[model samples]
Target: MVTVSAEESLDHGVPAPMRRGEVFTIHATRDDRSMITHRILPEIAVAQARQLNDAGWQVHISELGGRAFKPSEFYQLLSYKRIG
Candidate 1:
């Protein structure tokens, strides 16, 4: 399944600390491959996930839980298998 989520920004390939209300980097991953968008607002992340869903990709949004600093909290999880 494909999963969409957000994470803190990276500096030189290292994760940078984020302040509350800061922008996030969106991550969409399936198996070993990943797609990333940097410095995006939460709404844009959701829109992208929705677009993928509309295009017949099963997408899952990460839920708000685990680490209190989770950037994934910005959007709901979308998960799906490809429709035949």
Candidate 2:
């Protein structure tokens, strides 16, 4: 019997449908209270991150439950920083 780990299964060729609660989190900070946003779509998260970056805030996008097969763990997907 072959036993596949949860992480391996997730990475398999099979495409998993996006769950309703699946979301991307945008974290932005700039010498102030950090702002966090949860977006269900990647495009929206990227847009928000770009906006934050344009406004001089450092931004990063993370997917919920994307790291170490832990539902509570977040895996960073992209990061943005304003360049002088």
Candidate 3:
């Protein structure tokens, strides 16, 4: 028979995936500032930027999630920023 403590069991567990709009936990000093990132698609970002620009919102930042993937569906998770 074997027994495991709650702490031991939790230590071996993997963290859940980051949700769409969840703020990340960052290690920083009291005076430091950081961004809470979210995954956004590249094409969508571009289209949205153009739309927002036309509608009167100026975009200033955009970033991608990962590389151009094989399936291509994953490329949708990339992001971009533009100045409108």
Task: Point out where model 2 deviates above 4 Å.
Answer: 1-21, 66-84
Residue 80, candidate 3: Cα error in Å is 12
| Best-to-worst TM-score order | 2, 1, 3
Kindly indicate the candidate among 1 and 2 with the higher lDDT.
2
Best by lDDT: 2
Best by TM-score: 2
Q: By descending lDDT, how would the candidates be arranged?
A: 2, 1, 3
Per-model TM against the reference = 0.34, 0.53, 0.28
Clashing pairs in 3: 41-76, 42-78, 61-81, 62-80, 62-81
Candidate 3, position 35, lDDT: 28
What TM-score should be assigned to candidate 2? Answer: 0.53
- Output the worst ten-in-a-row residue range by lDDT, candidate 1: 75-84
- Estimate the lDDT of model 2: 0.50
What is the C-alpha lDDT profile of model 2 across 1-84, one tens digit per residue? 122212211232322223333456677779966887767545566776777778988777665555221212222232232111
